[model samples]
Target: MERESSALLFIREKSVGFTARVALHEYKRQCDGGYPAKLKKVLIVTAPLWFKAPFRILRLFVREKLRERVHTVSAPQLGAHVPRASLPTQLGGQLAPDHAAWLEHCRNCYTNNLQNNKLDGVIDEYVISNYIPPVKTQNGVIEHEVARDMTSDRVARLEQPDAMHISDPPYTCDTGPLRHTHGYNGDMKGGHIHSGDEDEVDLITRGTWSSGEASPGLSDEECAGGGAGESAGALLARLRSLGRRGLVAEYEEIRARPPQGTFHHAKLPSNLSKNRYTDVLCYDHSRVLLSQIDPEDPTTDYINANYVDGYKQKNAFICTQGPLPKTYSDFWRMVWEQGCLAVVMTTRAVERGRVKCGQYWPAAAGARAVHPPFALLTEAVDVEDDYIISHLVLTDLRSEMSRRVWHGQYVRWPDYGVPGGGRAQPVLRFLQLVRRAQRTALADLGDAWAGHSRGPPIVVHCSAGIGRTGTFITLDVCTSRLSAEGVADVRGTVERVRAQRAHSIQMPDQYVFCHLALLEYAVMHGYLESADLNGFDDDNEDESE
Candidate 1:
């Protein structure tokens, strides 16, 4: 078998230092102190901070410790070209002051250590290291995910497999993106293209994990080459059968209407408080724009402003073309300047020139000036990919779609300015926060629904605050209030939502997007149709596009 080898070395002669970060990577109890005969390939690195060692003796000891004894590097040695087996550090003053800190990160393992009988400042210490293994093990991350595709089995095998392992969910989450994003080409960037009701993008959603599952960072070629064991083509083909019916059931019209009933209309939880938001507009949810605004609507002006700097943010507004437009930029400016978030259409906001805000950015402000507190910038990835969503499901399923706006996550790109579109909202900073906070929220919501409800007269919004937001709200409410009622027509749900709010996503792409959103919600919770609700695997397959 042909194998490839790579190595990393770090050593600095100037301000030179040597440190060993040791961990029991593969431990067995056959006389614990014995050498690891099986560890044929090992990576060794030297730190940058200077420390004198009786290295002449210790160097020999380190060499003796290895079986194959492949990689070796020494700090403070330079002007030398050594074989692949060796690496030398540059001379003094060559390393960055933070090089040692960066080295600690290289080890990839974190721990607290006990130290005594040292200098006064030296005590027990917590340590972190980023040890890049010469070869990484399987724990793959998704590159790009769209509704029209699938993945490989070598892609599976989680530490402890569950629903999370079965499928990769979306990246949207409070804990930031639950999955790492690798490759994307803007297919889902502008917006989802409507594939027609009877036609859906074709692809596989699940795969079996045998041995040799791909690691998290392998390039696409490396992943494909990593044979994950062999399976029958028949089985693979069966899994690939295109499920033509909309992934989201078509509940074209409301089944039993709202029943004019006293639903969770009162039962929804008002768990959050007004004081919770010192600056209400500091973190704008994406649902707001997707549901409420339009370029033409005249009433979209937000009369309040509540945020940081807004005037110089370069955010363009759309409406009646007065002081503020009905655009999100205009409304968001108001949100940044004042505490007001108005319910209006995008066109109207644009026409107004400035969506009324209690506060406004200084005229000479930068985008960062009006930046929301919890907003984020991230590596973009399509949310519909199973691998991405499966990873999210493995992590925090509830937050997969709730946090960001109009499907686009706020991501940080330094020199590259943000891409613009009606549904777009800046949120990369918030994605980072979501990566950590979402899990707790999911645990709290239980399995009934993914998002925390407003309890009384709750509001759900996308960029327009109508289509995607309305659909999600409808599903969430029905799941919580009418789970017993068999799956209703999605179209019916949309119509009902429209009755409450006019012009709920007239765009075709937006319509398709609404269904996909529903699929994401249903699949994550193991509740796919009322029939499947009663503890049935229904592993039975075969769907056509």
Candidate 2:
């Protein structure tokens, strides 16, 4: 081998599968045992996000002098390191090598050398028989020069005899049943409330109260008459009657009740720094505990998140605080351990010049951000009018396995109040997009997800993980109920969520916004006529100050 030669490696995305990752890891181990003094420099281009972290970890095991020679760069940045004249046209260079001619010359030289030495007995017959010269096509293209499409037989022969055996089961990339017992205080209904049948009662009847009649609030008389039934129109009429004052009063009533469960884990001095707010704590009974990275250290399993039930499914959502700088690793660990498939972010990273949440993900497509053992790669991003959807792949460096996660961030929602200046259309539309994505991902899981009524818990977070987070969860649950049973229980849904996550619906306005969001959903889905909301004022002008 030439001592002063440099190597340039181009990695295509399709070639970086699980088997390739394992093989690369074994190669790294050999290199670390004995650093290659012959190679001067190695430049790797278009490497997958999963390969970057393990490479960095490999540097720690290699000699310091050899570490500085290896470099990883994007295609556009290659010019800064290497001259364009020495590169191939495919890699933004001026020269392209004639691979066919090079192979033919090599074969001729080998034949002459063999004839002069008479070394037929010294060389292996299998190696000599397999050496075939490159062939040219009708269009003058080298047919087998690159070996891009190698046959399985050739690959099997090339594989090392003592390859590492993987003992852990292969990751199906599908969510299984819940591993831990959920702490939901509500009744266990055993299955999903919505059957997804088109013939189900998705639309609400006009009921006894017409659009022209005065709104009948949820008074003692109405509760006894038709309010007790699961009628969507009756619920809407009661919600309209509440108006601003009644809604605020209803929120106050929920606050007055003493919170259930204790906060022993959250109050510990070691875990205090993990929480965004000192008072907004997760209930110990329902808190989601991380699988301890260090078995000896108990604090390694702490994260400010909880498992909250949705409609009829247990542990349907994992509500958590926005990840802090130190807790990014823990956030992803919880995501991986819990088998979560979706993440819904309701607040921006920065609001009013303050950092409300840390930027835990990559900033753009084809970029990656590492949080120690977990590396997140943004495969693609779709920007919409009110939100952004990211297609992400999360890789575990230790296991060399990966899973896909769908991330939806609603940017228009302000830190203090709802989006669209208290309007509900934007929020409802965003919810629709999220649900559609979730359904598609679940279906991709096939039989693993098909065995259960609901997929794994969807991770949700905002600034405090209560205000906007709670509101979004409430909206999801209430909308599903209304669609299945034609009834929206705004107050009951908020109470149920707060039972698991303390201080959920942080502000009274958020509590009222849930009702407004549900009403809009009812009208938009044809459950109620547009004229039904004629006398109702959906604005939050009188929201609590």
Candidate 3:
């Protein structure tokens, strides 16, 4: 038997749609060199019949006639194919279970290979190894040749007859600009060129990264007027030059590394134990210290939250999960202690027939609530199409100090999913409001936002702080980077956020959505050519990875 020509997938009880897709993706991606010869007879042995459904969707994503070769059989049926001496006893054969040991050995071998840099050689063998010269730029704008090199070839390949008939892998997040195929009808240049609202545009300025020391081979001429100073056309062109798979691979590499110190104490209770309300905890180093709030009790010092720094901005946000009913007071106390000027709430109080978040704030204007040591007064409320803005006045009863906070609740973004590309206006509009509010508050502090101490972190929360919260923060930070530095690194931004808060951008789809959302934001703000923003379908968004 030619082992390279055949493959077997043994599906156990824990196999889900994500697992099946991952297996298929690995097989397809790894066997790309001679895929036609490989996997000619892929067989799946399972205990139940329902496991076959995931493979049906696999065809739509993998673009291969995998269903034709995929065969799912029960344990009783496995005996007919394998010799009685070779099969496991559970499958009515004499062999005992040894697959687990073999898998462990394979893992060790792969680890050794990776440490020896053999993995890179393997990848090099599979790839065409196009000579990507060190990119050169002029006046902060990428040279047309560089942009052409980055996009034209990929688009041309995608336009080939064989490629046009194929579909993307299942559960893939479509970051409009980074995908291999050209989604727009040939005319990439045709789109809305101007912004509808000039007042909402962000201030773009040259950033620290513009210095040659930070970016080697980039002279002042190459980065002049770069960052926020670059024109929208140049920025969009630069953004379109990135490889989607390369970005995904970098993100995966970051996830594979173990954290240096998990800060187990930062967790509300023991790390081993968890409840439905707070299953995850922030690491100690990145966690917000509230020891000053209640110096007497150490328990009061802890909250299920972490401080996430933004691009060129420290303590940009205090990311946390939805406040549990009991921790509502702690949540508010953190906001008050941290001097947060705005709260970016991405999830609704309830979602999909489940209590996703606590109704921590007052429902209507003029309503007042006393959550102990702090009293929250809802001064006013303004409801918009995609979100609600509330004027909240929080008074710290202990110090008799009162502060007004803007509560921006984005209602449309679903839990564990992303806001569709077509419906980006509301989210972008809401984000602008938040940024403006933060800027005004920072300005009032005079140098605090920029100098010795940074401005108060914006308190952002969702059902789980890591998913939608991470997505929102990533978009905000990347946009800010684009405005100040004229460039954005999606993978780097996500890695920074994750360093502060564990598991930021929870799944692969969320990670990809971050890119898509940024692209949508660019179009809305006239930074990118605006095509039919609604042409992209984010309806089936999944956090499979």
Candidate 4:
């Protein structure tokens, strides 16, 4: 046996038991006779912290060359050694694992070997020598094309001519100018423009709004002029003029013209308890309908969530209330059904002596939480000063199919208002982190969403799902629009969002914060000069208090 080809071996920590350890030690003893020439590296992933010392001790017993080849790494660190695009989701990679197709490939290889009279009652080596991994299709179906080299008694790699054919172009973070429209399409039906009627007055105060007095920022004169073709500098100047009071007035003007979309499902008596807030409802036109868990009860289909459009991507987010204790299962169901790879949580479980959001996920890493049909395992957690990043694997109990999900919780936002004092730097930094994680998750999806630059909708929620949720989404949309188009249209973006998600950017303070956030982002990214924002620090100081 030449054994000249190199190989990489991946082992999951959970799979290594006492018996496996004994077997591994036996193999190590055998390696003393002569180490295998095939394996170039061995990676043990998801290793517990306690295992580190043992692994070091074990390495000391191995041959010097072999010790250097063996390694242990966390899931996030694995991408540095291997390309994430080629790895499976289970390993924190883009590819979805297909064990059934792999087994089928092994079966074909075994059958071929037996027919060729090469089995000799030992099919392991023969199968290994001839197995071909299945190719994943755009729809995530596994298809195999096996070609055998009879003369060499080995499997031949098949070339896929169309492997590089991506239905949608890969998204790039370009700051120049957009070649197309960058916000919501505003095509949702069943919505009527508000006529400032008495019936609509109560709708303006649906979700929790800040009670703090408005902080001054932009001057009234500076806030007076704004239109579609305004340059980035002009937009920043206008944002600077729109002091807290001006922004509040602008928000009230927007609220007066509310696009009141009906929420029949949300208001249904059976579904009323599912909603976190009585008045904050998902619109009929864009609600995320769940497949009924009970075929006899149609009420099981309702969850208080709507699909909000993103810049150039329709249904880019599932904006919903934070899961109530009773609706945790429904929440995970929505996650599983929609193929959401990330969850952006902007509020804590409890705020200001009240429960703001439910503690739906496991409390600590290496713990499990069962939500009926689905089980979520918190694989790892990385806590930062401003946010906490959770790596979770959600497994379907019935089907045994699992998907990795990233849960990012922004913990620094005030209970009463938005983040970043006045500049919105903290919130913007958190947004950057979320976007990077989302982009990586989208890429890992491996073309499941063939034609969309933004993949499956990211689940965003707060207590009421409108105030903080809307502010976060609005910041994302406006900044993305600014990045792609070289212009920021805060009013237009909020209007488009409200058209889908009614009452988005609930408070005038949040509306003002969006303008400040966009202005800060523009100046930071060189879209506008910092000099354009002079004297804004005084306003930010006032807002901070």
Best candidate according to lDDT: 4
lDDT of 2 by residue, 158-248 (tens): 3444321111111111111110011111111221111111222211110011110101111111211111234567767787677766788
Ordered from best to worst lDDT, the candidate numbers read 4, 2, 3, 1
For each candidate, what TM-score against the reference? 0.22, 0.57, 0.52, 0.58
How do the residues 1-545 of candidate 3 rate in per-residue lDDT, one tens digit apiece? 12321222233322333466666765565345453234433445552435456655664565434444344544433332332223444444334544565445445544654665555655322111221211111111111222122235555654555332111221112222212111111111111111111222211110101100111111112222112233445434433453444345656876786542233344324322322244466654445544224424334545777766665544567888888777788788878756678899999998989998888889799999888888999999999778898999998887787888889899888776778553556666787889888777677755222221335678999987888898888878777766665567666667667766777787666776666666776776666676342312233243332
Alpha carbon lDDT at 376, candidate 4: 94
In model 4, where is the ten-residue run with the lowest total lDDT?
207-216
Candidate 4: tens digits of C-alpha lDDT, residues 1-545: 01222233344444454333553564455444333234434556666656655666666776765665456655544443343333565664445667787677667777776787878876644444433232331123344444333233221211133122111111212211111111111121111121221222221112110000000111112111122535578876675676555677888998887444455556667888898888887765456656545645655767888776666555677889989999999999888867788999988898788998899999699999999999999999999988899999999898898999999999877654877455588888999988899889888875233324666678898888888888898888778777876876777767766766778888877887888778788878988667365664466578789
Which regions in candidate 1 have their CA more than 4 angstroms from the true location? Answer: 1-330, 333-367, 370-492, 507-523, 528-545
Q: Which ten residues in a row have the lowest lDDT in candidate 2?
A: 206-215
Off by over 4 Å in 4: 1-229, 531-545
Cα misplacement distance, residue 237 of candidate 1 (Å): 24
Taking the tens digit of each residue's C-alpha lDDT, what string does model 1 give over 1-545?
Answer: 00111111222232333343221122112113332212223323343323223322233343333312222323211111111112221221111233454344332222212122222332212110111111100112122221211122222322223212211222111111111221110112112211111212121211111101111122112212111212222212222342213322233323233221111101112211111122111111011111113334311322211111001110111111112222325433332221111221111212135432221222111222223222222223333211111011111122322222111122221111111231211222222233233334334443222111211012122333433334333333333222233233344434533432333433434444333433434444445431122211122233221
Pick by TM-score: 1 or 4, better one: 4
Ranking according to TM-score, highest score first: 4, 2, 3, 1
TM-score of 2: 0.57
What is candidate 4's local distance difference test score? Answer: 0.62
Each model's C-alpha lDDT? 0.24, 0.61, 0.54, 0.62
The RMSD (Cα, Å) of candidate 2 is 25.1
